[model samples]
Target: MNLPNILTLSRIVAIPVIIFLFLTGNPVAQWFAFALYVIAAITDFFDGALARRMNAVSPLGRMLDPIADKLLVGALLIAFAFAGSFTTGLTWAAIAIMMREIAVSGLREHLGSEGVTVHVTAIAKYKTMTQLIALGAMLVVPLVPGLELAAHGLVWLAAVLTVYTGVEYFMKAWPHLSGAKV
Candidate 1:
């Protein structure tokens, strides 16, 4: 496999380790998980960029990259939910993000099968970057008490973007979904 593809694979492989470490109830392990997660998130950006830069993009990489992203974000959010990392009011934010991911994925798959491509929008890229940053802040709250409020704010921000992008994607897919000409 090429380096870009390898990087994408590494992110998927890191999912379980990150969740396990974060769930260990130990500060050191949690920090380790956060560090690993940061690395994985960075790779998420670089993998696609490197693939394009090196002309190493492939079908396998294209398929696996988004899957890896969804897994890393969704799995960690669930782990955090189980760990009671989110307050009752904030839990809905996490749920919203996860639900949007699921819905968008299904929409993308359905459209792909119909020979229609839905490109990732710039706002969606910002949404993902905000999500990773928000999660990173949330994960390190135990190590840095000052980050708690900021972390919560970031989560809310990410949720807003999640919903907005979800609606945007749905609107774009609606005409196609209704079997009307694009």
Candidate 2:
């Protein structure tokens, strides 16, 4: 495997390590979890860049990259909710984020099958950035004052962006869906 693929796979591998650390119930272990999450998130950025720069992009990397991201984000969100750390708003935010993820993934798959491609937009990148920061903040709750509230606010913001992006995608695919030229 290329370095980019290795990095992508590393992000997936980091998920279990993060969960184990979070389950340790040690405050220090939570910090370790945060560190691993940061590393994995960083890999998400570097992997794509490396793939492009090295001309090592592959179908497997394309498939694994997004899967790794969704798994990491979903695992952390569900873990937070299961740990009873989420406020009601945060819970709703998490639900919306997860729901949007499922919806967008399906839409993208259908569009891809139709040979309709939608490029990732700035808003989409922002959504991911906000999510990573917000989740990391939530992970270090005691360390960050009022982080639960802050993280929930961020999650809500991300959810809005996520929904908007999904809608944009659907709008882009609408022509093809309607049997019109894309």
Candidate 3:
């Protein structure tokens, strides 16, 4: 119920509206979707900082923040995957990214059940940032010619990082998973 938690919830709420805008296929609607996405991404930063600064942190805020981020990126990635401006290569890259996200989420949940914690690495944070940028630029490709190619490059970069981070997380959980070192 605090401001920090509310901002985190707002990010999730924005996803369906972004989907609606993208589905419209109008140039203005796509652009508005990109704007809304940027706003949502910016709120990720503010919400965390505000929670610390205002001492408004709560269990709900911590739990919802990452979920909001994942949902936003996942939704935008899927939209770009099926959208006309996306390339065949971008679709494959999107598929890889989504797979990695899902695998890591499941792995984390299993580890959490075992009382094992996995921390987000610096590269993973960069991957998230690159993903957000790639999706945002891809959204604008319909309005700006030749931008789809750039977005494709960004997607590939994110894909590489995504795979790397997923592998790193897997390694972290390996011993616990096998019960050899726990």
My TM-score estimates for the predictions, one after another, are: 0.98, 0.93, 0.93
Judging by TM-score against the true structure, name the best candidate.
1
| Residue 54 shift from truth in candidate 1, angstroms | 0.8
Q: Write the per-residue lDDT of candidate 3 for residues 1-182, one digit (tens) a residue.
A: 98888888999999999989988999898889889989988898899899999998887897788788889888887776666555677777778888889899899888888887778788888888887787777777788887867877887998898889988889878898887967
* Model 3: pairs clashing at backbone N, Cα or C within 3 Å: none
Clash number for every model? 0, 0, 0
What stretches of model 2 exceed 4 Å from their correct place? none
Give model 2's TM-score versus the native structure.
0.93
- Indicate whether candidate 1 or candidate 3 has the larger TM-score: 1
The candidate, 2 or 3, that scores higher on lDDT is: 2
Q: What is the lDDT of residue 76 in candidate 1?
A: 80
State the C-alpha lDDT per candidate: 0.93, 0.85, 0.84
Predicted candidate 1 versus true structure: per-residue lDDT over 17-125, tens digit per residue:
9999999989999999999999999999999999999999999999999899899889988988999989986799989999999999999999999998999999999
Candidate 1 weakest ten by summed lDDT: 137-146
Q: Write the per-residue lDDT of candidate 2 for residues 29-116, one digit (tens) a residue.
A: 8889989989999999999999999999999999898889889989999998888878787788888889888888898788788776
Model 1: lDDT of residue 107: 97
